[model samples]
Target chain A: MRDKFNEQLEQLNVELIKMGALCEEAISAAAKALLEGDAALRETAAAAEREIDQKERDIESLCMKLLLQQQPVARDLRTISAALKMISDMERIGDQASDIAEITRDIEDSPVVSHVPIAEMARSTIGMVTDSIDSFVRKNLGLAQEVIRKDDEIDRMFLDVKDELIRRIGQGDSGETCMDLLMIAKYFERIGDHACNIAEWVEYSLTGQHGDM
Target chain B: MRDKFNEQLEQLNVELIKMGALCEEAISAAAKALLEGDAALRETAAAAEREIDQKERDIESLCMKLLLQQQPVARDLRTISAALKMISDMERIGDQASDIAEITRDIEDSPVVSHVPIAEMARSTIGMVTDSIDSFVRKNLGLAQEVIRKDDEIDRMFLDVKDELIRRIGQGDSGETCMDLLMIAKYFERIGDHACNIAEWVEYSLTGQHGDM
Candidate 1:
């Protein structure tokens, strides 16, 4: 029975890793679509979002079954519960990525603004998300902490993006274009937040206490 | 033992309602702060946010204890698990409210813009949140659906807010002010999303399937 449980647990970890990879793909596609004015990648990101949603349901059922069939105690219970919470964040990351794609689709034909630091912000956020998931899969507390620390940088980047948009608007740029850029930057910041949340859950699962505790 | 479980469940419901009310207060306070240029009310919202965070931690511990000690199955398990998910949404609602408050604090001394329709959006979102929690407590699937439907109106209002901000920016209004208003409207839209999520979980608890299912 213990061996079977461990096997199932390992399967859960594998599924989570797959879901994380999907999120990474979705966000990276969305970012590239936004930066390159590529409308086709928006569709790609949307498809990935749908897949991520399906993955969430699959992982949720697995966690519920593990909880019910195994009635896991202590660390096992925490791991499953944390997986449950982590997937919600992962699913939202996917949703936010889709949202970014939707916005990029709308602005795909518009004249591109070159001054916003959005591409760099997107890269940083993607790294944070990947590191957070890796921290979870490897149970690396230090990596999780690093993800948390990186959030401040994302926040700062968002402010920079906002300021840049404001400056462009004041310089007589189209308000609509500025608004779209601002929204995309804000989505990247939100994705960073979800990544931080996943890292915190990873920490909780490993140590049985969140960072605040 | 069954009676004790029922009693604990009732207590959990009460706490959830209390947390929901706090969310309503925080959002309302933040809205008033933004509309009235009331910096004091921003502080009030911040205080409520702190309380809401405390309540989340408390409720989480209670849920964990219930899960570990009672080992509930089937419907009972669903209800507890749904509550666990609902609190995360509720906590996010609180955070969004506080975020709105923070933006208002920065703009409180600025000349107020009166055309954003934020007040109506806040009222609609607060109603959705209240109804979602009520649906959970009463197991009212109809009310849950109502809350879900209400989300569309909030989304529409957010678009209206965005349009108004863009119009103002085009009319040579302060870019900073427009950006602040846009962020506040976005936060309200996000609160509506969280409320919809809570309502979906409530529906899941009652029907054993999420809205998507």
Candidate 2:
């Protein structure tokens, strides 16, 4: 019985990693679609978003089963609970990616996007997402802390993007296009936040210390 | 022992209601601050945000203790787990309130804000937050479903706000002010989403049915 419980714990880890991969795929596709104006990549991002949502449901059920059947305690309980929390953030990241894709579908690309550092922002946020999940899979406290710290940079980039967009608007650039780009930038910043949240859960699982607390 | 568990469950309910109250206060203060351009209300919102964050930590610890000591299963376990999930969304509502307040602090009252339906959006979102918590407190599945349905209207208001702001920008209104207004509107929409999430958790606790599923 103990061995089977351990096996189930391992299964939880595998499923979380898979869900993380789906989030990465979704965001990457959405960002690429934004930078390149590629319709195919937008569809890829949307498809991955759907897959991410399904993965959340599946992983949530697995965690619930483990919690109910095994009645895990202490560290085991923490791990499973942390998975429950992490999946919510991961699901939000998928939604943000989809929201970004939706915007791209609604409007054509404007030169205003090239004026801001949005592509760099996306790359940095994607890095945080990748590192955050890696920290969870490896149970690395240092990497988890690093991901948390990286969020400040994303926040700063968002402000910079906001200021630049405001400047473009002042210059009488296409107001709608600037609005869309700002929304896209905001979504990227939000995705960074979810990645930061995932890392915090990793910290909680490993050290029993919630970042906010 | 079962009697003690029942008392603790009641305690959990009380704490959730308290946290919900704090979230409502934060958002309402922020909205009032934006409309009146009142610095005092912004400070009030900030204080509520701090309290909301502390409340999250306190409630999280309480839930963990209940789960660990009681090892609850079935419906009891579901209720406790649902509370755990609900607090995260509640905490995010606090953050959105803070974000809205921050934007108001950065800019003066603009005439453009008066032109948009932002006040209506804020009112609708605050109502959703209140009802979402009320549903959880009462375990009213109908109220929870109502909150979920209301999210669609919030989404529609957001697009309306976007279009109106875009038109203002096109008319050579203050670009920076319009951008700030748009961000504030988006934050309101996000709070509505968080409220919707809390209601969904209420549904899950009551009926074992996740809204997304």
Candidate 3:
């Protein structure tokens, strides 16, 4: 019975890693859609969002089964509970990515996009999302802490995006377009936040310390 | 043993209702601060947010204790798991309210505030938050469904806010100030989304159905 429980726990880790990869794909496709101004990638992001949602349901059912069948305690209980919480954050990341794609699909050629370092922000958030999951899979507290720390960099980048958009508007750029860019930048900032949340849950699972930012 | 478990579950419900009330206080205070241009109310909202956070921690610990001590099955287990998930959305509602207040405290005499129906939007979101919690307490699936439907109203209000901001920008309003107002409206919109999430969790707790929106 103990061996069977361990096997199920291993399966949980594999499912979480797969869900994290889907989030990365969704966000990356959304970012590329914005940077390249390709409406096609929006569909890619949307498809990934659907897949992520399905994965959330599947994993949630699995977690419920584990808890019911094993009645896990201590460390095992914490791990499963943390997984339940972490999936919500992962699902939100997918939604934010889809939202970014929605905005990108409607936007035309806007010069505001070039002035902001949105691509760099996207890359950093993607790294944070990936590393947060890796920390969970490997049970590495230090990597989870690093993921939490990296949120500051994303916040700083959001401020930069805001400042540049303000400058462009002051220079008589289209306010409508700048607002669209602002919304996109805001979505990316939110994705970073959700990634930070996932890392916090990872910390909670490993250390039983619920760290709030 | 079962009697003690039921008592603890009752306590969990009490704590959840208290946390929900704090979220309501935070959002209401934030809306009043924005409408009245009262920086003092920002501190009020911040205080409520702090209380909400503390309540989350306390309730979370209670939940862990219940799970470990009773090893609840079936409906009892679903109730505890749902409580675990609902708190996160409630906590986010508190954070978004504080965020709105933060933006409101910074702005000085903006004409866009009059143009947008922000006050009405605030009232609607406040209603949704209240109803969502009431549904959870009553386990009324219909009330929870109503809360989810109300999110559409909030979304419509957000578009109105966006359009008004765009019109003001065309008339040469300060782009920076309009951006600030937009962020505040977005925060309200996000609060509505979180309320919808809470209602969904309430439905799940009662019916064992995870309805994604």
Candidate 4:
């Protein structure tokens, strides 16, 4: 029975890794779509979002089955609970990426990446998402902490983007354009937040406490 | 053993209702602070947010204990899992409300409620939060669906707020003020989304499936 439980646990890990990869794909595609003004890439990101949603349901069922069959305790219980929390964050990442894609599609005529370091912010956020999942899969405490630390950079970049947009608005740029760009930047900031949440859950699963304890 | 589990489940319900009340308080306080330019109310919202966070940790520990000790199956398992999901949404509602209060603090000199129907939006959103939790506590499917449907109104209000902000920006209003108001509106919109999530979880807990089968 113990062997079977361990095997199921390994399967849960595999599912989580797959969901994380899909989230990365979704966010990266949304970023590329925004930067390049590529409507096709927006569609790709939307598809990835749908896939991620399906994966969430699958992984949720798997976790439920493990809990029911094995009734895991202590560290094992924490691991499953953390997985449950992590997937919600992952699912939100997917939704936010889709939201970004929607914004990119709205602004297909005039991409907003030229005036701000939005592409850089996107890359940074994507890295945080990837590293947070890696920390979870490997139980790497250092990597998890690093992901948490990266959120400050993401927050700073969002403010920089806001400042630049304000300057452009003052210079008589289209208000609608500036607003769209700000919304996109906000979406990236939120993606960073979800990544931070996943990293915190990873920490909680490992240490049974979250953040700076 | 079954009676003991049921009693603990009732305790969980009571705690959830309490957390939900805190969220409503936080959002309403933040809204009042914004509308009235009342710094004191902002502080109240922030305090409520801290309380909500503590409640989340306490409830999470309870859920973990219930899962590990009872190993509840079928409907019982679903109830616990739904609680897990609901608390995350409720916690997010608290965070978003606090975020609104932070924006209120930043714009104490020039309140943003004059040009938009922000007060109405706040009232509607607070209603949704209240009804969502009431549904969870009472297991009222009808109320849960009503809360979900009410999200459409909140979304429309957010768009209206955005359009008004854009118009203000076009008329050479302080971009900073307009941006801050837009952010505040977005936060309210997100709080509504969280309420919708809690309502869905309430449905899932009672019905074992989420949304139109």
State every prediction's TM-score relative to the real structure: 0.96, 0.94, 0.95, 0.97
- Model 4, runs deviating above 4 Å: none
- C-alpha lDDT of candidate 1 relative to the true structure: 0.89
DockQ of 4: 0.68
| Recovered share of real interface contacts in candidate 2 | 0.53
Q: After the best TM-score superposition of candidate 3, give how far the Cα of residue B211 lies from its true spot, in angstroms.
A: 3.3
**lDDT, residue B72, candidate 1:** 91
* Chain A TM-score, prediction 1: 0.97
Which residue segments of model 3 deviate by more than 4 Å?
Answer: none
Per residue, candidate 1 scores C-alpha lDDT tens digits across B1-213 of: 888888999999999999999999999999999888888999989989988988988898788778767879888989998998899899889989999989986776555357778889999999999999999999999999999998999999999889888988998889988888888899999999999999999988998989865
Give candidate 1 misplaced runs (Cα > 4 Å).
none
Q: Rank the candidates by DockQ, best first.
A: 4, 1, 3, 2
Q: Which candidate achieves the best DockQ against the true structure?
A: 4
Cα error, residue B79 of model 1, in Å, equals: 1.6
Worst 10 residues of 3 chain B by lDDT: B105-114
lDDT of 3: 0.89
Residues A87-178 of candidate 2: C-alpha lDDT, one tens digit per residue: 99999999999989889876556777678897798889888988998898898999999999999999999989988888888888888888
lDDT of each: 0.89, 0.88, 0.89, 0.89
- Ten contiguous residues with the weakest lDDT in model 4 chain A: A104-113
Model 4 sits at a Cα RMSD from the real structure of 1.5
Highest TM-score: which candidate?
4
